[model samples]
Structure formats: structure tokens, C-alpha cells
Target: MAKKPYSNEADYVIVGAGSAGCALAGRLAEAGKQVILIEAGGPDTSIMFKRPGMITMIHSEPKLKKKFDWGYYLSPQEHVNNRRLVATRGKVMGGSGSVNGMIYVRGNKENFDSWEAEGNKGWGYADVLKSYKRMEDWQGPDSELRGKGGPIKVLENPDICDAAKTFIEAGASALGVPVNPDYNGASQDGMHVIQENTSNAIRFSSSRGYLTEQELPTLEVQQRGTVSRVVIEGSRATGVEVIEEGGQRRIVKARTEVILAAGAFGSPQILMLSGIGPAEHLRGHGIDVVADLPVGDNLHDHLFMPMTFAMDNSPHHSSAFYFGKALLKDRFKPGSNFLAHSVFEAGAFLHTSLSQSTAPDMQLFAIPWSYPPFQDDPVRLSPDKRPSLSAFSTLIRPKSRGTVRLASADPLAAPIIDPKLLSEPDDLKVLLEGVEMIRAIMADSAIAKHVKEEYEPGPGYTGDKLRAEVIKRVSTVYHPVGSVRMGVDERAVVDPELKVRGIDGLRVADASIMPTIIGGNTNAPSMMIGDMAGAIVLGTGL
Candidate 1:
């Protein structure tokens, strides 16, 4: 590993240079406060990080994925055939924002309003929307609901495939919903073309938008360093103990604050490692307790099952030759690539029959290309050569919950993650309904014309057999949240202001603080949390 002189002190020390970390660091530095952002992974240099088409390939190849992904595995889930599902999180400079599908969604408005209703003040839809607009620079259709000039560049996907468009239209007709031009505006329901946080064709991750693009002289980024624990003294966070890439230990001091933006999994794991979790769990690990809050409880994620079809007519710009050409030119000229935007360019939100809130219960994604089937053995996939189109059924709100505990006290050791997916009967029931809804849309005349055959769950599958197949195929959409939840309740790890309950000068700004998981992709919401953190710390209103 190459070595550089690392900074030992700053006004603010932020662990994890992910979506939230980068945004918060940028804002604080712009306010003339010296900030140090620490990242566990190296710099983001892979071509796969810049080209949107290469994201699917990264998921397919294990060796390529390990280059930037944490590649954590959940403990065996009994309800879903005791399968140990794979959880992919970006370990690079921008974190998951650099490696994700690049889909931009603010989730449902109700998701935020419910936070206020649950006793988290100043966190309602109206309050959070100001932060969203403050950070976003939307290039989509003109609307008062959308923001124009901000750091994060969000634009409508211009490369929607014919197959995806057809699927959206057919689904809208089958579900009696309109083809909404911008789901991020007005309402979040109906079939719609989604947006991406991209400038031209290159992905504009938080590192790019906030760190690299901004002119902040006071911000210093420390990469390839693992934060072992927060250094707390007298019920106040003063700094962090880090293991550098060269295997040297050092303590970095923060004069004002220490913030953890290490995503849902990493934040709680770091908290437990710092001896700030449940009293029994910390004592069992032989660590002195700092706080006895439920730091790792309420772990939940969205469940997804994909339905694929072999297309008789090939979708234009989906061939191997075009992908190769796009990869070569996409780095220099942005939109020249056929896969300029994300592969999952269009999706829909629908209220299932069992929806308990005003928000939609399920979200669907349309993919013009076929991906490899899910398998636990080897956990590596080979891309299918056949021309195909896939629709994903995602249960956004699940009743099932689990926990994140220490595999051991080692900071570098992987955390024991048990999402306990499909543990609740209602979760399986709603996921089944989502799968059937996709099947109904595919059976329609508009989309059936392109279908050669039903690939995964076979056309003959029905009733009990179909239910069994859903169990076999169900997996994570990779949108995990609510691990280190924020609230006014006793179990909450962080307060409404993102401050740790019993620890001063410490805060959490990431997906982990979501009181409840949002109803859409988590990357955008996580960045919004970072934006809000900066405002709160600076005492500036959005």
C-alpha cells in the first residue's frame, strides 16, 4: 500500500466518505470549518464506476465485484429456504453511490411525514423537501416540485430501451395507472421513467459532486483507513481510533464533533465495536458499555424477486457489440453509450391490496437485458447470452426485522447480519401479490407480442408451486436501512437531531438513522440525510 502523511486533527472528523459523509464534509468545509473525511476503501478509479452499463457486469463477476464492494452475506434466513443472501455495498470513495444502479428517487412524501408523526420534529415531508431541493440540480421536465441548480446532478434517463418503454405502457394499462413522466414530481405512483444522478453519461457520485467538484480548502479526505472505534471520554466523543492502510494505528482528534456516516451496516457495527449498544450484548463481548440503547435492532430491507422473459425480437442497442462500443467511448463522450443511464431505467410504485398506509406498498423495475439467475453456491453469475427482458417485483415495506451484531470485536471483521427476510407471513403474502401483478402485465397483448417464453418461474407454474418458487427466488434489492434508527423513543440510538442519546459531540448521518425504511432506492435518501446534517451542524436553515 502506498503511504501519505495523514492528518491527526481537525475541527470535525467524519467516519466513512460515503454519500452522507461527502456531503456533510463539503458543507462544513464550505462554512470554513476544517473537516477530515475517512474512508475504509481506496480511491474510486475503476472504469466500472463511471460507465453505467458496467454495473450489471460488476454484479455478475465476483473478482470484479470485490474490487470495490464489501460483499457481505446475511445469516441464513429460515423462511426463505434458509438461504444466506448476498449483500453488496460499495467500499470505494463514493461508497454505494459509486457502484449502485444510479436510480434517483426521493421515496414517497408520506415516508417523511410519518417520521414527524412518530415524534421526530422538523422531519416531515415539507421540512425534508427543502433539503432535497437544496442539494439537487434536476434536469428533468420543469416542475415546481423539482429543484434546478444544486450540487447533485439529476437528469431524466435518455436511453430508455424499447422493451422497457413497452413494459411501462403495458403495466400502466393493466394496473389502470397513467404513464407518469416524472415519478419524483406530483406523486410517486404509476408507471414512470426514473432519473439518475449523472452528468452527461458518467455517474456523479457524492464524491464527484460534493468533494471533487466543490472548492473547499478546509476539507481533507483520508482514504483506505478503517475506523476501529469512536474515542469517547466523559460521555463525549472526541475523536476516532483508525487503522491505516500500512497497518499503523493512530488517533485522529476532532475538536468540535465526530460523525458516523458508514451506512446502515457499518454505523451500528462501529457503535457496537465502540461498546455503545445493548448492555448484555456489549458485556458478553467483554467491552465496557457507553450507552445501553438498541443500536442494532430494527434491521429491515426491501425484498425483490425478478421475472424474466426471452424476447422474440431483439431489443435495439442491447447487443454485445453495442455494449463493447459504448464502454470504449462512454468515458470520453457521455451520452454516446447506449447504456448511458442506469440499466434499470424505468419503474413503478403501486399500492397492494394489503397496503396499510397512504403510500404504495410495492415498487417494480424494468430491465431490458437478462441477468444471471440467483444461486447461493459460488455466488458468482455468468450473463445469459439470450435476448431477454426482466421485471422486478419489490416489497418496499416489510414487517420482518432482524439485527446486526459483532462477529467478533475486530474492526476489520465482517458483522453478523441477520435480516430475517420473509419472517413475517404478511411480507411473503405481499411479495407474492407483486409477482402475480407482473405476470398479469406480461400476459397482456401489448407486451406478450415480444415474449418468446417465460424464463425463470416457467409458464406452467401455479398455486402452491408458484408460492414455493417465490420462496426459492426471493432476494434483497440491496436497499437496507433502519439499523441505527433515530427517534424520541427509548430504543432509539440517535435522537431527532442525529445526536447519540448519551454521547455528546457525536452524531449519525446516513441510512442507518432512517426511523423507518423509505419506499424507494436508498442512495438519494441517504444523501438527503447528509445534507440535513450539514444544516443542523451549521445552524443554517434549508
Candidate 2:
């Protein structure tokens, strides 16, 4: 059969050209299947998108956020001081992968094993490991655990600061554990340097790795296009109706499948707009129900409380100064600056007393600067001018869940998002334990030498007061997932193969399909999901 001309149709129509969408489209196209990848945002051609070090700047600057981020705000949480936290999701071509911290964490093996245990067959670590290895082109030395000659290029943080190194050493000393050379490898516990999707001093985003790096004759990318809804006829998804920037709407037919790779929030929003969520909710929105399944339940995310320390008599300058230097260097040298090192270079995954499983419940990030002096959004404040060290204690396995619902039937309107952070008592307990551990690590001899004084969440607070401070300061680590989950039971929106329940030729191939939030940064896993989703659709999945 001859290939169809690139028009308003294709073999596969993937919405959202982000981390997962890019990979899924690339895979299908490489296999000779015509694909159309649609992105709401423009291309990933900005300098801010290319530089590895620009992440800190991106979060700190509101103008940049306006251009790159979805700018969604979670509802005020009753558990965490009623604070309305901002959810920073990428709106660009590469999605969050282009604007995130760039840390590449594959999550714990137990994360996947548990998914399979929950009747989601073939999702165990062993099955997904093949996908991870298949998507990675690691710069690390030869190892069967890691891979080479893959789509995404992975590299270690270059020019790691002295403070980050000391923090890693201090973590090992405080925990009485050896520094694990690779957390993404055999073990996820202990201190280690984080690897990211970066190479040759540039960010290797999913758009760059999969869409731009290779030529796929069968793939077509449509930018500045927002998907309004999945076009369904009876019980089958035929294609999608997309709204262009000029308010023009058109339908792009999908001959085989319509895959939603639009992240956690967007995927659910699109589904509900297409009348495929809870029946009551769809009726309230004036939309007819196609499926009465849970489309937006089980929303969960990681929360981190930052601990900053004043650096006295430090060897390195302020991160702000280095950022400025890098900016100037970019004008002359280009891609040859210290900004290549993502801010949180070294980290540790440790288990708290509250942890029920062997996998660590908390994660700590070491920053070489005084980051966000206040508890508000990092976008509101620039890096402190003074030299400082900061470590963030993150609740990796949060139990609290929330929901995503359609604010209205309007496709342009943002969805209502609520992760209900720290609602579970044990989640707060794990976070408190993480704070204690971070305080201990700061006291270690390796890191104590540079410390001047405890900064924000300052000294003399303990017990109730400390808990209050924790409530006041804890914020999202920008990892939100599990809204449109995959499983075999009642709450599952998608099945083992990521096919939506009660819908034919419709699948979800992004973080939204995760039944349980993985115990690490979700970018890598989302990409793997996209990669393997293509295989599953092609009848080649493990």
C-alpha cells in the first residue's frame, strides 16, 4: 500500500508534542506508520530551551514562565496552610522536559513491580527496563544496566560545584551508607550525582532527542495547535478537532489510533471535553457521557521542603553571579559555560521510619546556591546574591490524592487541578523525617565547614512550630501524575495496553496513564511509556 499524503490525516494522531508525544510519534513514524504530532506551543528553538543551565533562570523569571509554562494553579489545600500552589507544566514543544530541572531518574524497580501487582500486566520493572534501555543513549561507561545508541542522550552534570560534592559526601556520612555511583542502576538508595538529558552543553529534550535529531519521512509536526477534543463516532475515536492559534478549528483524521500524550492534566481535560469521564461530571458540563470511568481521579505529586544555609567563607561565588557570567559567555562562546550543570546536581534517596516498603520514601536535592529565600514561587524571587548551600527534602511516595475536572466545556479554559498535598498524615510524617535527616546531613563535617547559619525555616523551631513551618514552606517539586491511571479494576481509566476503557482506537501514552506515581522524577518514565506504547500498538511490546 502506498503512503497517504501529509494532509489532514495520518495513521496515528498524537496530541501534545511533549516528552511522550514526541517519542511515540517518532517510534511509529520510524516503523513506516504515518504520524501527525500536534503541539499547542511553538517550536523548541529558543535559546532558553537549549541551554542546560537556563532552568533556574526560567523558573525565576515570570516573562519566561509566561512563554513556556502552562501556568496552572492548584486549588488551596486545607492540609498545607491553605496555600494555592502553582503547578509549572511546560506549554512548549518539548513540554515539561524542556523547562524542568533536567534530572533523569528512572524511579525504583518496586514502583513498576507494584503496578503489575495491581493487575496491570507486563508493567513490572523487568518489562519496562527494556523500554528505558531502549530510549537511553547514556554517556556513562559500558554497563548492561544502561544503554547507548538510543534516542535520548544522557550525561552527568559537568563542572559540579564544590558545595554539591560536599553535600553528597555529607549525605553518605550522615546516613552511614556508601555513595551509590548510579541511582538509576541496581540501587536507588544512598547519595549520588544525578544524570540529566543533556549533552555537549545543551538540553536534550524529548523534542530534540526524538523529533529533531532524526529524519522521519512519515512524521508531521503541527505547532501552535491546541486539541479541543477527540473526535468520536459512536464508540470509536476517529481523529481529533484542533483549534489553531487564529481560532480556526479543523479535524485531522487518524486512520488507526488517536493517542493522547498530553500529560496528566491535559489528557484528562481533553477526555472530559470529549464526554469520556465520570457520567455525572460530564452531564454537569453539558456534555453527553461516552464512558462513566474515572478519568481524573488519583492525582498525586511529590512535595519538597527546601532547607537553605548561609555559606560563610565559601570557595565558590553566588549562583546568580555565575548565571550572569554564563549569559555573557553565551553571547561570545555559546554553550560553553557553567550553566550546563543543572542546579540540583547531587541527591539521595532514603527511607524514613514511615516507609512501608523497601524503596526510599524521601529524596533530597543539593543546590550550590541560596535558592528562593521565601516560601512563595521561585518565579517570584531571584537567587540570593550571597553564596549559600541548599538542600530540598522531598516526599517521594506521597499517599494523598486529588482530582482534575473540567472547569467548563470550553477547550481553551484551564482544568481545575488539586493534588491535595500532605493530606495523608503519613506523608507529612515522611517529610518531617526527611527534614531531620537533612539537618543531620548539614551537620556532617564534610558540609559543616562552609555553613554560616541555618537560613529560612530558621533555627529555634521544633515540634508544633516546626510542623507549622513545614506546612508554610513545602511546595510541589513539579512532578504531577496518576490522574488518568491504568489498571484492570474499577478506577482504571486505561487498561494494561493503555487503551481507554469503553473506547475503541483511543489510547493514552503519557504520565497520565501511570497507575501509581513512580518514586522519582517522572520525565524518563513518561518517555519510556511513550516509547513502549508504540511497541504495544505495533504488536511488539514485551
lDDT of 2 by residue, 165-278 (tens): 888898899888779888889999999898889888788888999988989999998887889999999999999999988898999999999999999999999999999998
Top model by lDDT, which number?
2
Model 1: worst 10 consecutive residues (lDDT sum): 375-384
lDDT of 1 by residue, 1-542 (tens): 88678889999999998888888998899999999999998887666777666776666566767877887998999898999888888898999998889889998999999999999998899988898888899987677788878899998887787787788888988888888888888788899887889886678888888888889999989988999999999899999999987789999999999999998899999999898998898898888899998998999999888887887654634445667776677657766755577888678999899998889999999887775567553245544567888788899989999999988888889999998998899998898898889988888877889888888777777888988988998888888898999999886999889999999999999999988899999999988999899999999877
Candidate 2: which stretches are off by over 4 Å?
A: 1-6, 312-322, 374-376
TM-score of each: 0.96, 0.97
What is the model-wide C-alpha lDDT for candidate 1? 0.86
Taking all chains together, the TM-score of candidate 1 against the true structure is 0.96
Model 2 CA lDDT for position 194:
83
The RMSD (Cα, Å) of candidate 1 is 1.9
Residue 245 error for model 1, in Å? 1.9
